[model samples]
Target: MQFSIATPTAAEFAALYLETGWGQWPLETFERALAGSWVVCVARDDDNRLVGLGRLIGDGALHAFVTEMIVSESARGAGIGAEIVRRLVGEAHRRGVRDVQLFAARGRAAFYERNGFARRPDDAPGMEWAGESRGTAVP
Candidate 1:
């Protein structure tokens, strides 16, 4: 697989998301998310299929959140997702961002640990404002 910071179309992104069993979302939502991202990294197979994708979102220099690290079902266990996370984190550091964070999917802490992330202290202060208008977006 080849990895690069180039982005894929929203259609391709949504398709890859679906391929991961994450269900479906509108292409425009994907488009807006891509447009607002600080950076996007993609991994493609030999045939140039969109097999993996990762995004870094935040101010370019001081903070970044690594989100949507995705690898197609067929491409899982091949290190594509890990490499994508590495690249995103590297890009954040390269930009001098000292605050980097990511929300790991449930039961996926081991994967993040392998990618050089540690658990936040149990007492770390954080909260969610899950208001009625909030929408669900997870993978």
Candidate 2:
């Protein structure tokens, strides 16, 4: 299986989101959010079908966060996810982002660990705002 990385347009990103069951976000919503992104990476198979996507968002210098990292179920074990993360990290580093972060779901920690991420101390907890808006609020 051949893999290649490219920056995706808003429509492409939204399609990948739906395919991966990340959420049901519309193209307009994706366009608005992607416009603020520092970079977006998409991994595709030889046939040019999108298999994975990840994004880095921030002020384009000091900090960035990885979001929407996902791979299609059919492509999960083919290392596409790792490639997506690797590409996103490379892009963030190239932009001189001093800090990059991502919130991995439970059972997915090992995946990030393999990509050079270390688990933070338990004392430093991860928090989120559970609501329809999906806006993370600090408690």
Candidate 3:
């Protein structure tokens, strides 16, 4: 396995998504996601096929959020995912960004924890706004 800070093309991204049972995102969304990421790291097999991916989206100096972290099923147990997290975290730390965070997929918290992330406290759990919900509450 080899890793590089290269952004995969949309076709590569789509293929991996489908290959891993994650439905494909639209091309435009892929483009926007990649464009908005502060860093993207891709892992390739010996034959140079994209087998793992991870990226950070942040304001470059203060916050870096890890997302879209996936390793192809064939490569799942090879430590590629952990390495990807290390690289992403290394980049953020290098920039002196201390607010790194990620929403681990269900059943994936141990993986992130092993890579040095901690779960949010119950009272400070992450929240998401549903697109269909009315934003009626104001502070």
On TM-score, the candidate that comes out on top is 3
Worst 10 residues of 2 by lDDT: 127-136
Residues 8-127, candidate 3: write the lDDT tens digits: 998888898899988977888888878888989999999999999999888976667887798999888889998998888777666666567778788988777777776777987632
Instruction: Point out where model 3 deviates above 4 Å.
Output: 126-139
Sort all candidates by lDDT, best to worst.
Answer: 3, 1, 2
lDDT tens per residue, model 2, 1-139: 4444456687877777788777877688988887777777777777877778777777775667776687888888988888877777666665565466777787887788787666666785432212121322323
Model 2, TM vs. native: 0.79
What is the Cα-based lDDT of residue 82 in candidate 3? 87
Model 2, CA-based lDDT = 0.70
Q: Candidate 1: minimum summed lDDT over ten consecutive residues — where? A: 126-135
All candidates' lDDT scores? 0.78, 0.70, 0.79
Instruction: Please list the residue runs of candidate 2 whose C-alpha ends up more than 4 Å from where it truly belongs after superposition.
Output: 1-5, 126-139
- How many clashes (backbone atoms < 3 Å, residues ≥3 apart in a chain or on different chains) does model 2 have? 0
In order of listing, the candidates' clash counts read: 0, 0, 0
